[model samples]
Target: MASFEINGGKRLQGELVPQGAKNEALQVLCAVLMTPEKVTISNLPDIIDVNKLINLLQAMGVKIEKVERGTFIFQAKDIDLDYLQTEDFKNRASSLRGSIMIVGPLLARYGKGFMPKPGGDKIGRRRLDTHFEGFAKLGAKFNFDQQAYFYSVTAEKLKGTYIHLDEASVTGTANVLMAAVLAEGKTTIYNAACEPYLQQLCKMLNKMGAKISGISSNMLTIEGVSELGGCFHRVLPDMIEIGSFIGLAAMTQSEITIKDVSYENLGIIPQTFQRLGIDMELRGDDLFIPSQESYQVDTFIDGSILTIADAPWPGFTPDLLSIVLVTATQAMGSVLIHQKMFESRLFFVDKLIDMGAQIILCDPHRATVIGLDRKHSLKGIQMTSPDIRAGVSLLIAALSAEGKSVIHNIEQIDRGYQDIDLRLNNLGADIRRM
Candidate 1:
């Protein structure tokens, strides 16, 4: 297990260019399997999860060539379908949560797909029902192996139909959309996840000859094409990372400029932080967060306590809630962070509380953080990272805390953020990776 040794209580100053979207990269990389032609994708993040998915594709016989850093050309001309039955394939597929997405393209082009129970962050119960259920709606026969925890979908031909999702799941919507693009006739998906990354997928697919309408809306209509062709696509900057950098700047009292953020796509993220009383200046495409001694949480118009909750698109993202909770530690007022999607996401408050933040773990879904308002500084302590978001949140806390802090299991952090320590160190943060 890798660990990060951080020396805290120093203000940082520099610019950070956010990496390409991790969530978007996962979806589009899997989409390469739907076509035999070459697809050139740029701005790919060099993170563990993204790299894992890329490697998984390569193992399945997709010819991949590196054009340069953050760019690749993929051709699925000769995919070895027999490899799907191997134990090596099962083990590799089961380890990555994103691997479940490959089933969509495989089932679309090859008439069958199989995946073991996919693995990812243990934030809560991330069910695969949405994916398989959507597949079943598209005329695919679905089966599950109880003993092996395996899932399989097969069909001679898929016929698209109307699908109203149980939940607006991003991955679920992506999986179903990929399958429906090659199905016979039209597919209308209501209540689809309209996240920017999902929209990026739709745009990419449209460019590749898939007739997809409603690019930025929940109701997506896809007119199935006989086959999809190759198209060049570039991923947007990761909004979650941009949000993290904003919080980090405020918490550590750093003047950091996040460049080429694709500001318009970051729905509600900037305003959500501003509601926390963090001052930011939007200079063209860059977000400049100046150093602050103390920031304040805003109250409702009726003077009630501010509640920051996560919802579907156009609402604040749940991924950055952990960052928000940690940033509020030194703010001027209290804010309630309601993590609606995942139950265990708020469980990381114990680590922050140990670091001297006044946080109340109301339950599994919510946390009330009472800002110290800079009257007190968090004292450093050794801790372990539970998940990706929590790990980065803890790292941010450590950077703003007093003395030294040791964080174990930094692989969780590496899975999402690319070269986090080195990037922050360039901006004057004292973090040693071991």
Candidate 2:
């Protein structure tokens, strides 16, 4: 369990480039299994989860070649089904939640797919019922062995059908999209997740000869094709990382230029930060945040209190709520941060309160943060990272504090961000891994 020892109050400067989208990379990489031709994907982030998935793909006999540092050429011409059935395969597959995406491609190409229970951040109860239900609606039979903690799906021939997901589950939509691309006839996914990640998936599939309409809407129409071809795909910049950098700049009172941000793809992120009274300038494809002495939280037009909440695509993403919450601790007023998606995500505010921030954790989903208004800097303290987003939020808080702070379980942070400490250090942050 490595930790991050940080000397707070170091204002990061200069230009920084955000890494490729981690969530998008997970979905797009799984799509490689849908086609046998050489699929070239660029802007791949060097993170633990993505790397582990690449290794799992290689173990399953997918031929992989490095095109460059952030690019890869994958050809899944031959897959070792026997190898996939081994205990070693099950153990590795169960280690990451993104690995569950393999089921869609595997079931589409082969007749069956199986895996043990998937693992990821224990922030809340993330159920796979959406994935299973979507698969079953697409004419696939679903099975789960409670004793073995395994799930399997099978279909002799998948027939397109109408699927209205119970919730707009991101990975669920991607999994079904992967399966539906190669099915027969038309498949309609109502209430689909139209995030940039899913949109990129749909676009990449279309480039590979899959027919998908409604690129950025709640309803998606897919015309099933017998096969798909390989195509080149460059993932969009990680919106979550971009949002984090915006929060980092405001929290630490720093000036930063985030290069090549793909501003068009970041729908509501920039505006969300603006709501926090943070000023940012858009310079071509980059985002420039000037150093700020103080920022205030805006109340509603009726002079009511302010609320920052998360929603689906075209709405503020839930992933950045933790960053928003932690950053609000230093603002000039109060704000209610509502994390509707995950229940336990807000529990980490207790650690922030211990560090001298005024935070009221209202149940499992909401937290009220009273800003310190830059009057008194936070006192550093030892803390445990709860999950990926919370871990990064804590890192941001630590960087903005007065003294030294130590954060344990930094592996959680590594799972999402690529070389975070090294990259932040280059920008003048004091973060040491020990």
Candidate 3:
């Protein structure tokens, strides 16, 4: 029920460090359950979602030590099987989508896994078909209790097989991959997600003695081993956070530097922002963005209005589309933002429209933004954040608006971004948490 009270029209300036990948932390944390030895993970995002998953793991009898800030050591040798059937475990598991990942490692190691319906942002329908379908292909028996809304999968011993996923769902890929790592024989997965988070997951699994190839491609080959050992793995910087910062700088006309971004992994994000007329320079490990009074959107080579849309990987990520959409409201041109994965994500455009930004919501998934070109700045308004990504988008708009803006229901924002209000305040943003 907390709110962000922001005085707008303030430019942010400073070097802000990006937090560790939230998506990667979820996948890596679950992958730790594949081994019984000590596994140390560093640069873990201290966000609400991650902490909830960690607490769930601790409740399940996994030995976890908070070695230091943003670091944890995990040993899953003493998992309590009885706890998995408890009401507390079910309630906690239903609260986190990351809990679905535990099904894979548990099934692989102990031949059984059960979970309640996983919950997360209600942007759209996020189905668990890919995870269960992949498991069934590997000889697991899948059953669902409609009355309890519970799902369970069991196997005597998994036998690897080829699987062609219906979609390259990120969490689905991670879950299936974890299950296949300890199964017998070889497993080939076509159309698997190859995002940086998945790349890190594969590398970590390999370090733990799993045979996996095709690191950056949609096709992955895994040779199942009998067991896995512990390994130390560090998550890459959050690209979503970097994108949000760049959008914030552009909309507020601020000079900001994002440090240690691991540029090699941010494949096409920078160039995508460039299309929105953002000027960014990658200096070693830092991305420097200078203040600008006005930035114009780029047209296509054919002189047509540019369209920004989300795709699988190496394409514009759907996670950052909200930032891009909000940033477009201040640019000097018109751009169509299409969010393909989630239907309801684009509904937040109504809030921006209320703030005096000219926008057209074409459908549940498309928004056409007519930039003000800085002819007049947006007027601050009161709004409630719909989700994690939309919350930050509103915050960005509030920083660039004329008056003051109040954002309620910020718990959604806290689920992903790590202390975002404090971090932005450090960079001179006039934001107060109330």
User: Relative to the true structure, how large is the alpha-carbon lDDT of every model?
Assistant: 0.95, 0.93, 0.94
Worst 10 residues of 2 by lDDT: 79-88
Residues 218-261, model 1: lDDT tens digits: 99999999999999999999999999999999999999999999
Q: Native-vs-model 3 lDDT?
A: 0.94
Candidates in descending TM-score order = 1, 3, 2
**Candidate 1: which pairs clash?**
none
lDDT of 2 by residue, 1-434 (tens): 99999999999898989999999999999999998999999999999999989999999999999978889999999989888778999999999989999999999989788888989988788999989898898889998889889899999999899999899999999998889888899999999999989999999999999999998999999999999999999988999999999999999999999999999999989988888899999999999999999998899999888999999888899999999999999999999999998898888898899999999988899889999998989989999998999999999999999899999999999999999999999999999999
Stretches of model 1 off by over 4 angstroms after superposition: none
Order the candidate numbers by lDDT, best to worst.
1, 3, 2
What range of 10 consecutive residues in model 1 has the weakest lDDT sum? 346-355
